[model samples]
Target chain A: MGEQLRKTPYHDLHVRNGGKMVPFAGWSMPVQFRNGILHEHRKVRGSAGVFDVSHMGRIYFRGPGAVAFVNYLITNNLERIGRGRLLYGALCNHDGGIIDDVTVYHLGDEILMVVNAANADAVWKWASELKPGDVEMVDATSDLAQIALQGPQAESCLAAPFDAAVKDVGYYGYAHVSWEGAQILISRNGYTGEDGFEIYVPTQLAVPLWETLFRWGSAAQLEPVGLGARDSLRMEVNYALYGNELNTDVSPLEAGLRWVVKLKKGDFVGREALLAQKKAGLRRTLVGFEVAGKRLPRHGHPIRSGAEEIGVVTSGGYCPSLDRGMGMGFVPPELAEIGTPLAIDARGALLEAKVVERPFYRKGSVKR
Target chain B: MEFPERLRYTKEHEWVRVEGDEVVFGITDFAQDQLGDIVYIELPEPGASLQRMDAFGSVEAVKTVTDLYAPVSCEVVAVNEALTDDPARVNNSPYGDGWMVRAKLGDAAQLDELLSAEAYQKLVAELGG
Candidate 1:
């Protein structure tokens, strides 16, 4: 396979623990463990699970004008965010299309932006061009590694290695903790829509911290999960993925993420286009659909109304928790209402479906 | 992977067993493991005619969809309707209840082209599964 690509700190450990390895985002990552996807996914929903997210990109912007430069690039209002707080926002292009959905952290004078691994280079280049005189943009992706501890028992599991104060870290808020003489950034945010902590540390020190957490949190029923479970977990909560749900051709407003776009926060990239589109009304909108039968619609499947094809499915899979097939796709704005009957043409056969609310399953520990 | 010694195998990972002139077909354990959790299976009609190595149907797992190929030249005689409601049977019992179809053999000579269990096991091992 193309030299097998780069590996994370737990690569060897994953293989030893019966993990099925697959190439994802140019990295050799685990797809599933010995317990399988269903067991691992339910484990995270009921208890806690650790994930190796080292492939995610970490970019740092420093200097005096870092805040101003970032404000001009992203669609969210950074002035409202305080230090140690995380903001879920989107980086859009000049045409109002989403470049990438990211989490921005205000780290005092500097800003730390976490992006999807597959869109790292694209986001870096886009942000680099916006860097003016004072701001210095550095791609700190290779210098750092990230791990996520997610589920209902996440807080107690993380409290062992860190401090009891880690429990008080509010949702979307983060704190810098000193573990094994290394300063790691721990944020109470995750894509699984569960109460979790995404910890960022130096690349070399990742293995030690992983081992410590796995060893100490073993009693808490924390299993080392892989990407297969991760995808199902996020899909269960209807979280958007980079290539599947969001892309350069789809705008944040069209994807139902208008809450992240702050039009009143002065001028920013894609602001005018978004404002104009908001005034004119959106032509197409993304909606969640549940397959009415046993047949599951796949990505690139044609969505139809009667016999006329209208849209295409962007992401689809069988939701284990929901015990049905679920997917996200962009249909005509008139047909975007909840409970709208739709059909997905799976090859030559038509599978009955209905457009429901965003999340297909909602019994997660996200707010807890 | 568990390759039953009495079963015949295809290069595409389909397994078949001949009972009189009728043959039962399903994916092997190696195929099921590689596909992850199977969510759906689209089977052909009972009266459909199949050619050797032709697409008979498809199996949908969580992240992938694999096209099922006919193991031998035969006329489809029966389809396992149990898979319509419970596709997970493919993961639970790939060789038994998960059998996709039963077909009456048109050419018995086509059965000899399939791999023996020992040969199939060696092929799976060589493929790094």
Candidate 2:
């Protein structure tokens, strides 16, 4: 093999199912299946789709200082989120630049920090190096695999195979359910802007779960979606992707994630800089734009206002749900208002685009 | 998708078929397979002239955007209007209905440098789609 890439537990299954494997964050992950991204994206929005998100770091934090140390590290209010609740927020450096966006699973006795696959190692190093007294974190990635069953029919699809107790878990809530004779953590939340469940199980049980899901989910037309759809789906909902929307150079506030920043929650990492930026007002703001036609406003393409370069596109592509090309980019606050006319440098040519309201597609089963 | 022996191909995985004086061109099956799903394709207007190997248009798949290169110097004669609405035809029918652009030959001699079907197959095999 040409420089062995790390494989997830479902790697063999993915290949057998015609997943187009691509090198992502050093892992041989499937970008799209044979059915393609548009199909996969539409499937998830219309019904249910499964995703193998096992590459994400499932680092466990336990001990007396677990809550305190995590509280100090993250931007969200971790102390109040008792057990079985999920807190979505970013971990920033002292400079307020977002290091990684993660979902903290509060399990009362312990906490599970689910981080981005690509940023897992660096995040682990960063957290491990600055670890305060008493708290400890262990990388549970190799031992665990995460599977998300997302869409409108997610609950019904999961209700048959998993325990009935799982039905009680509300949005952003989790339950320890007996799945295939194994106690697996199932969370009633997902990234696809759908009402779904994220099942975290032992690595060995991953394949069985995937198999059982496909078998049981077939009635609801559940498809095994890949990252291509995962990306477009998230983009349609305007969920901030780590490398594209959030990065080390950009603060969470600048990326329209100011709601997650807890300045009054006491001294956390990047509080000082965030406070300063808040006082000075954001210079550049991340905004959503709709391309006038089929031309894609690709990443790093310049955002323009009458020949003046205002900002740059971070993520852009065709959104199947919206049936149009759309993208997210940063522009001056003055130029970031909704319906403002904008031009994007799509490859060498200037394409007509305009700032639009967030979430190119809004008919999602997210809150349902 | 069958690669007609009469047609010619480029190393970039584009196929060309001569229709009298004008020529029709499109991405090959291998290119569509590699591209996954073509969501948007931007082609130049009719009557635009291009140099051999010059980038004429761009194709956007859900995963990436790739430039469509001119296999030979030619003037654009027509583009597939159907593709403007449903570009997935590029994936479903990479050879027939998915044809992207037609151009009058700028230098018909350039066809001599194009690869034969067998050679194109060998090139594809070496690249390993």
lDDT of 1: 0.89
Per-candidate total of colliding backbone pairs: 0, 0
Across A261-314, the per-residue lDDT of candidate 2 in tens digits comes to 888999888899999999999988999999886778777999899979888899
lDDT of 1 by residue, A33-126 (tens): 9878888888898889999998888999999999888888889999988897889889999999989999899998999999988888899899
In angstroms, give how far residue A73 of model 2 lies from its true place: 0.6
Off by over 4 Å in 1: A1-4, B44-49, B75-86, B96-98
- Which residue pairs overlap in candidate 2's backbone? none
10 residues in a row with least lDDT, candidate 1 chain A: A159-168
Cα lDDT of model 2 by residue, B20-42, tens digit:
88999999999999888888788
Runs off by more than 4 Å, candidate 2: none
